[model samples]
Target: MALIGIISRELGNLTFLVSLDLGSNKFHGNLPQEMANLHRLKVLDLSFNSFSGEVPSWFGFLHQLQALNLGNNSFTGSIPSSFYNMPKLETLNLKFNSIEGQIPKVIGSLINLRVLNLIGNKLVGFIPTSLSNASRLETLEISYN
Candidate 1:
């Protein structure tokens, strides 16, 4: 249910705030680390794909990013801790991946956070107190009791 004929370039002329939805596809292989070049990316959806490997750390470089979806992929590894630097990030949907490790205390850095869904993953450790500081937070779904 997977193949590699994916649209591999979006940065050639993309400038304005952009949104991409490539969910429910049969894409296989790593998410191209080139997305960070879309410095103006405001929303991105890559859910329900066959993407493997670690999510690139450069995602934190997208200062204009407002929402991001990397759910239901085969991504394996700890979430890049640098994600806390995206000061404008509002909605983050990373619900179903192979992501392990504690939700970093840095998540509190996302002051504009509305939804933080890390539910149904292999994460472990105590919930970080930093998350509570997000007064704007609307939802936090992680399977840890």
Candidate 2:
């Protein structure tokens, strides 16, 4: 596995909005929590890797985040409740992983959410009611085991 530079912080000031495409790479390890510092980030794609560990709890602070894709990895743990604070989230893709736990109730607060994909995971329980609160929700896919 390769160790890549974490450039998330440099983009926090609006000089740049972070976007990562390390998908289909040989990179393996827990995702760095420093990524949460990318407050000005808009898009983040970290799919198709062997990355493991729980999703960072600080993600809720990303008020400017739009698209977030963390699919096809070895990640484990419950979806962070802090994510409910994401103010501009639009699309979220997190399929094919070991993520487990009930969908957060705060997810419904995301009035701008369009697509939320949580397929092929260990997560259990029926979809939460908060999902229905999404006035702009186009799709809510959760294939829990």
| Leading candidate by lDDT | 1
User: What lDDT, from 0 to 1, does candidate 2 have?
Assistant: 0.79
Instruction: For each candidate, give its TM-score against the true structure.
Output: 0.89, 0.85
Worst 10 residues of 2 by lDDT: 6-15
Q: Which pairs clash in model 1? A: none
lDDT of each: 0.81, 0.79
Cα-based lDDT at residue 120, candidate 2? 92
- Superpose all Cα atoms of candidate 2 onto the true structure and report the RMSD in Å to 1 decimal: 3.0
Q: In candidate 2, what are the lDDT values of residues 51-117, reduced to their tens digit?
A: 7889878888778888888889887999898888887899988899899988888888888999999
Each prediction's Cα RMSD? 2.4, 3.0
- Model 2 compared with the native: what TM-score? 0.85
Candidate 2 Cα outliers beyond 4 Å, as residue runs: 1-15
Candidate with best TM-score = 1
